[model samples]
Target: MPTTGRVRHAAPGLGHSGVVTVTGQLGEFLRARRARLRPEDVGLGALPGRRRVTGLRREELAQLAGVSVSYYTRLEQGQSVNASDAVLDALAGALRLDDHERTHLRELASRRPRPLRRPPAERVNAMTLDLVRSMENVPTLVLGRRTDVLAWNPLGHALLASHLDPTAPERPADRPNVARMLFLDPHCRDLYVDWDRKARGVVANLRLIAGRHPEDALLASLVGELSVKSPEFVALWGDHRVKPCEGATYRLRHPLVGELTVTQQALSLPHSPEQSVLVVTAEQGSSSQDTLRLLGRFTVTS
Candidate 1:
């Protein structure tokens, strides 16, 4: 891809403005992060003169990012656009950005000039519901493309969805979003002991999803709402972090059975691009396993 050119916008609307804003914000973020690091961080020779700034100068960053000083400057100023992924990666390396920052840079560079809004949420298919049912013993849940908890086995409902009203409709409008529940639900905050870490992880996963589906108005709206409601959520979102939540262990304090540790994994449904199944399990013979068994029994009785 060529390094120099202006990106063409299909129409003058929120989409176009969004792209420009994304690009400008990304450049500003990179510049700010880079300016905080010292030359020794990336093994560059120290300058003799008194340095005015803390980190690499713009010219030095251009040299490190492998673009012309003028071009890098324009990118930072939002003057030149259409940055390719390769260029962004190179710049990320030069800036010594961590994994989260690198992903953010790529996302910004790859953003479409005209982003589309997500359409209405569709109903989950029968087969998908059946799959969740089959995993009844395990805490299994089916999440929509926007990460809405569309369907879940009883155990899953008992484990995660318990934060929301059990009688709430399973539609996007009424359904409980995992991210929202994690931040907004008082029970969720109490359930997860390391609430801050878990909160950021949720935001980062949403960031990755948002980049892939930038036109998704529902996803954008969810993010926007969380940002306003939770100051911690707002701080993490502004960091421009990104990640896929494939697997992780979570400790939950169940009201009925006390504390339990469970390893949660996300599995993509082969037939549906808009659905995924999340399963949670405890290691055999562990105390957490006992708690899980007790919880399962309670669910059965209830």
Candidate 2:
């Protein structure tokens, strides 16, 4: 899974990208997430004068979370590293964080430095490619550690992202991450009927991965790019939630198929925890299953 809820290292703050001390990241993520709130929205009484600052001020956030302003300021400033579960829970509640966001916050608070590893090759191996091909009727994809689309079966491409160039998965540099596509790509954006719920799931899943692979620079870069490009993503990331993306049923408004409900299941590769196969299907004997079966007729198996 994944999260804005990534790590603090020498990570550069929002806007300007590239490596910087991650020390400031927790604060930046907290500040950014907090900036989206309003006083009345959280049941705080409105002030008398013309308000200059946006969202809940740091002091207000601290107050709402049941902590002193100075300590919360320290935490936001990256000065406080001894965050406890109870404190994080309180803070998450104050910020209205979901389960995934809370996990991200915990991960951020507890991060320690490790030498960055050689960036992992995101290419799909021959065996994995072969396995994908074997699943002719299944809408399946091999996802890299960061959820990059490393490989896809013909039905997978047609059923999930037909609008995208089918060859995208072949290029490591240009590979598409399903999470990014969910928010940034128009076709992907319109695919899911419950957009907000889907978005939360994506963020939560990403947050979980962030905790597991803190030293992955590419993963960090993806989060940064998304943060800069999508305000919705930024807000969701700040919520610091984590979700294990095992399986879920989604109602999709597929452009070609009209409407369909499908259950998505992810199976981790035996040798590679970093990658997994995601398959989508409708219930047996259901009309949605009939529609899904119809999609296979148009599958591009080249």
lDDT of each: 0.73, 0.77
Q: Report per-prediction Cα RMSD to one decimal.
A: 6.0, 5.7
Each model's TM-score, in the order given? 0.83, 0.71
Q: What is the lDDT, from 0 to 100, of the residue 45 in candidate 1?
A: 81
Q: Name the weakest run of 10 consecutive residues (lDDT summed) in model 1.
A: 5-14
Candidate 2 residues lying further than 4 Å off, grouped into runs, are 1-17, 27-73, 82-106, 113-118, 125-127, 300-302
Q: After superposition, how far is residue 226 of candidate 1 from its true place, in Å?
A: 1.3
Error of 2 at 79 (Å): 1.1
Reference-based lDDT, residue 234, model 1? 71
lDDT of 2 by residue, 1-302 (tens): 32123333222332122333444657866886687789887998765677788788887888889999999999998888888888888888888887666766777778764544437567666878888888888899998878899889778988889988888898887787898899899999899888898899888788677666666766777777788788898878776556778899999888877899999899888777778889888999999998888887756423
**Consecutive 10-residue window with the lowest summed lDDT within model 2:** 2-11
Which pairs of residues collide in model 1?
A: none
